[model samples]
Target: MRPTSEAELSAVISDATGPLNLRGGGTRLMGPFAGNVLETSGLAGISLYEPGALTMVAYAGTPLAQIEAALKSENQRLAFEPPDLRDVLGTSGVSTIGGVAASNASGPRRISVGACRDFMLGVRFVDGAGAVVKNGGRVMKNVTGYDLVKLMSGAHGTLGVLSEVSLKVLPDVEMQLCLRIEGLDATQSVEAMSAALGSPFEVTGAARGVDGSVVLRIEGFEVSVRYRATQLQSVLARFGAIDLIDDQERCANIWRDIRDARAFASGDGDLWRISVKPSDAPHVLETIGRNKATLDWGGGLIWCEVAKGLDIRAKMRVAGHATLMRASNETFAKLGRFHPEAAPLAKISANLRARFDPRGLLNPGLMGAAI
Candidate 1:
């Protein structure tokens, strides 16, 4: 169902057939799923902007490019640095800000700037009850009841269908630089990556790719970026470093994959995204070292493409949590890669789902077990 207006959106949600699968652009939803899809491409436009307050609100269906362009006009940007999913999903375009916030798709900057949820000021959505509810507000500070606005940031439409949203914006950096340390093994790479993050100097992006390399990004004024880059180079000298001058196109290309899990999209093997403590990376990778893997998020995230017949669940048990990035339909259905039920907080998740979508009609089992 296409909803061009709020009234149309409300009408779509009120459908009694099944729980609605709220989608913006329907990019990620192309994967496996079973539900009545509610396409929200109609709800588009920037409703309000307060430059003095550094806040903006846009319809859920608005393209991210439009929002970024509007924010750029004021020399501001979405600080969380949401990545374009096209790299991993092999889709044609970037993810919408609505989908980015809904999926909580933060990038390497998340270590410093914070996730999409943190920048969310408020939201306007239609819950399963078909009632329009508003949470938070356009202002920076709101200490009202439960922070439903923030809660919905990563709900992936399981709770409600977002009609519009309010977000905080940050001024763009004057300059940016990415420092690379090539030819380092995973162990050395992790060490250098950790040292950079531990230092007083702010290092924005950190990742070790499949090519046995480590890289970090520093952004700020020219003087600060130069100084921090030099300091980071000095610290990582033991790992044999190489300086990557920040070129707009090159920078965009390198980070596009890092942000969207593109580096691991080489073959048709099953793909897994593993999140773990940075220190435990070596052990986990050694355990699953046989599989093709690349490190991101400073070794905290492991992209492992496993051979067929391997037990992906066992791999997730070893690591903390794993998401099925790319896999066959048989693998997806049989392996059950997105296991929300196995998570420790599953019970509380069920309760929360009931509160937001009591009817269990929104994207049931999409993210696993309705929770």
Candidate 2:
């Protein structure tokens, strides 16, 4: 089912009988696509775009491509760099802006800027009760009470179905440059990434491929990029020959691949995304043992391809969070898809769900048996 407007969406929810699968372009689905389905892609178009204000408000079903194109025209872009899930998910579907917010998707630039939630200024959605709810506001710098805007950002559409969203955007830098340092071991890679990130160069991206090649990115005015790249080179002279990647398209492709975890997309095993302290990454991975893993976000984010039934969770105890990025249906069925929550946090989650969706309706069983 597709509703082109909020009123249509509310009416659909008001009449919903059982579990309804909320879909936005169907790009980020995990587990089975059971139950009746509702698609938000029908609700499209940008409601507002104020380039001077660096703000854009679009209907939830608006294609991300549209937003990107519009932002590009104004020399601005989604700084968080939301990932396109089609390639990684091995599915053929265009990602919608709403899906990005629903999944709280962010990419390579997220390390420097922030996640989708950081730019999410406001949202309009339909609650489980079929009521039209608007939180936050159209313009930025809003402080009008309960921040349901954030609560809904990564809720996976469990709390509500997003009908519209307003986001904060940043102007695109004039130039993008990268330094590829090769031959760095895991420990060395972690240290190098940490040093680059801590430096005043304003490094925007840091990624280490499984082959021990680490890439560091810096973007800004051409002069600033050049000067900082030189300074950064001097600081990392000990790391040895650094190949500069200034070619616009190539640099973008590499960063885009890193942002989307495309490096592990073609691998055979199930994929797991582990988030840990940047400096603690090497130690954590050493304990996890060897499995094809790519490090991103200056070692804060690790993408590992582990085989089925490996119980990858038992490999480490970093006091960090782990997400099942991509896995077989059987694996999801046997083991919980997300990190196991402790009692205290689990209680809070339950309360939030009950407060917003007491009937246990929206996306039932997607996030741990609903309520």
Candidate 3:
């Protein structure tokens, strides 16, 4: 099913008696999808573009490349710096703007600013009941009730079919510099990242390369970037030889992979995106049998590629959740996709799910039975 307009979408949804497999860009069509296929690609076009105000509202199916190119021309970008999961998900489909919002996919800059949810100004979607719903507003200071925009940010389309989204954009920084400190182990790298993040100089990106090298990014005005880099160099000199990957192309290449966890995208091994405390990184890695991994979000996010059937949630004792980013249908079914929610949280989640999707007919199995 394809919906070219919101009214057509409502009619199709209202008439449907079975679950619909909502597809956006097809870049993140992981896990099992039941019933029939419903494509959002037809709901395309940017309805609003306030470049001076740095705000944009586009149809859910608008290609992210289109939105990004438009933002680039205006010297602005989505403040959250959403990931292009096409490469990581091993799919060729263009990443859609709605896919980014549905998954709440954010990049390295998330550590400095925030995730996609933080920039979500508003949203328009068709709920499971086939009713059109709107939340938040086009401007930044929206004080409406319930905050459905946030509720749907990472709901994975279990709640509704997103028709449109409004977002806050940021001006592209004038300069960026990355301080690559060599030879630090995972734990040491986390410690270094912690220090950099805690310091006065604004570090936009922090990650430990697979080879155990630490890279920290700071962006701002050209003079401020240079000054901050010098200050950071002096502060982090104890870590070891500190080199600079300040060139735009070089820096972009390295951070792009880290942003999307592309390093582990090649293998057949199950990929886990664990959200643990920065300080608990080493323990979490040890619990996962010290698998090959890349640390992002200043160590709060760990992307590890490990053999299939490994029970990461059981060993993962930290106060965080592990999401199975990529795995086969058998592995997903056997091991489950998302971490099980706590009892109290589970009840609340059930209530919310009931409120949004009473029939359980919207991407029913994508989040697994526990959700």
TM agreement with the true structure for every prediction? 0.92, 0.97, 0.97
Model 3 misplaced regions, further than 4 Å: 368-371
Q: What does the lDDT read for residue 142 in candidate 3?
A: 82
Q: For residue 67, what is the lDDT in candidate 3?
A: 96
- Tens digits of per-residue lDDT, candidate 2, 1-371, equal 99999999999988988777899988874676466788999989999999989899999999999999999999999999998867776877778999999889988888889899999999999988899999998776785989988999989988999999999999999999999999988889988988899899999999999888999999999999999999999988888899999999999999888888887778768888888888778977787678888899999999888777566677766678788877788877776677777888878887887877777778877776665
Better of 1 and 2 by lDDT: 2
Q: Candidates' lDDT values, in order?
A: 0.78, 0.87, 0.86
Q: Give the local distance difference test score of model 3.
A: 0.86
Sort by TM-score, best first: what order? 3, 2, 1
Evaluated at residue 312, the lDDT of candidate 2 is 63
lDDT of 1 by residue, 1-371 (tens): 77888887777777656756667875662346667767777788999988778999999888999999998999998888887766465556444667877888788888878889999989989887778989999876774998888788878887788888999899898988888778887788789889989987898888987777787888889899888888777777777747767786676667777887777655667778778888878777887867777777778888888786466657544547777767777777676656445456777777887887787888777665754
Where model 1 places Cα greater than 4 Å from the true spot, the runs are 29-31, 244-248, 316-319, 341-344
For every candidate structure, what is the RMSD over all alpha carbons to the true structure, in angstroms? Answer: 2.2, 1.3, 1.3
lDDT (10s digit) by residue, model 3, range 187-274: 8899899989999999999998777788899888999999999999888888888998779888888888888778877777888889
User: Which of candidates 1 and 3 is the stronger one according to lDDT?
Assistant: 3
